[model samples]
Target: MNRSSARRPWHQHFETVGSITAIVVGVAALFVSFDQSRVMREEIRASIWPALQVDGFASLENGTLAIGLSVQNAGVGPALVERVTIRHDDSPVEDLDALRALMPPGADLSRTSLTGRVVAAGASVRPFELRYPAEESDDAIDVLNRLLSRWSAEVCYCSTLGQCWVASDDPGAPTMVDSCEGQPGGDF
Candidate 1:
């Protein structure tokens, strides 16, 4: 065979290198795409995140004693309240009426349902309110303080995006949950 025929073609070497480089680039592109998708999903969740807080308010002002329990939405998105579990001294209270029975008589009490309610961002829903004359403030304050000490609440809410969380009167951050199904106690 001739000398030129004995040597391998240079273009064949280039072709091999080109094929390997193409595969590496393709794999790198796939990883980048996956990361971008993960980031996008996180952004979507954050955009509709909802935070709920169970708050108690009491004040002796304007010759009136005002005491209230409310659920506030502090997040940027609306909170869809799914379930509410209210307890007194660690026992479940069946409904609003039962809760009201635990309060002192002679005070005007008003309440709104928390379950199946929608709380908008930066808005609050007063689930329970008690008003008494300032002349009764001293007695009301003592009773109210005792009542509050024995009261606790747990709220399960979802974001507009369907992300679920559980917030309670306990001290801690809200916990993420798969769903807000089958909570104990009657709906309030």
Candidate 2:
């Protein structure tokens, strides 16, 4: 009932409640910020191509070396392969033929071109093929055989977002190894 004592209790209560509320808000904000940062990082990693697989071998027809690749999208978002770097037997080859002899005729690259979205998250196997204009000879066949037996192709893509993805398949596939995906890309 005394004025001083009554005011003291109210003041103490106010201070304790205010401090607790401030701490709770601060902790909540920190957790939210951390979660947002994690999500952003994950999104960046998903936008890039994660892996590549060789479905089969490339085919040799006329004077062209046809190759196949199975590109996969292992990101949280879609990806495309706009450019490619292929190698045969650990050596880089300029033309596709240097690695086509070992593949069957059906795996020709003449009609292979990545169009729509290939390889979605958890979706395996986006088959693709490649071709090069060059004659097939005995020596070339030997080279092709060796190359197809141990061939690999790296593919690059452009996304509307600001980033791209790359996927590769060792050896080859029945479809074009290079594909295109049109999706808004974001900076990683």
Each model's lDDT:
0.82, 0.52
Q: Model 2 over residues 40-153: C-alpha lDDT tens digits?
A: 977776565334343445556666665455555444444444555566566665544544544444443543444343444555543345555655453445655665566666
The runs of at least 3 residues in candidate 1 whose Cα sits more than 4 Å from the true structure, single-residue gaps closed, are 1-11, 136-144
TM-score of 2: 0.44
**Model 1 lDDT, residue 1, Cα:** 75
Alpha carbon lDDT of residue 156, candidate 1?
92
Q: Write the per-residue lDDT of candidate 1 for residues 1-188, one digit (tens) a residue.
A: 77764586765567777998999999999999999999999998888788898866677877778777778888888999999888889999998778777776777887788889899999989887888777743655675667679888889999888889999877677899998997775557
Ten-residue stretch with the least lDDT total in model 2: 179-188
Where does candidate 1 clash, by residue pair?
Answer: none
- Cα error, candidate 1, residue 81 (Å): 0.5
What TM-score number comes out for model 1?
0.84
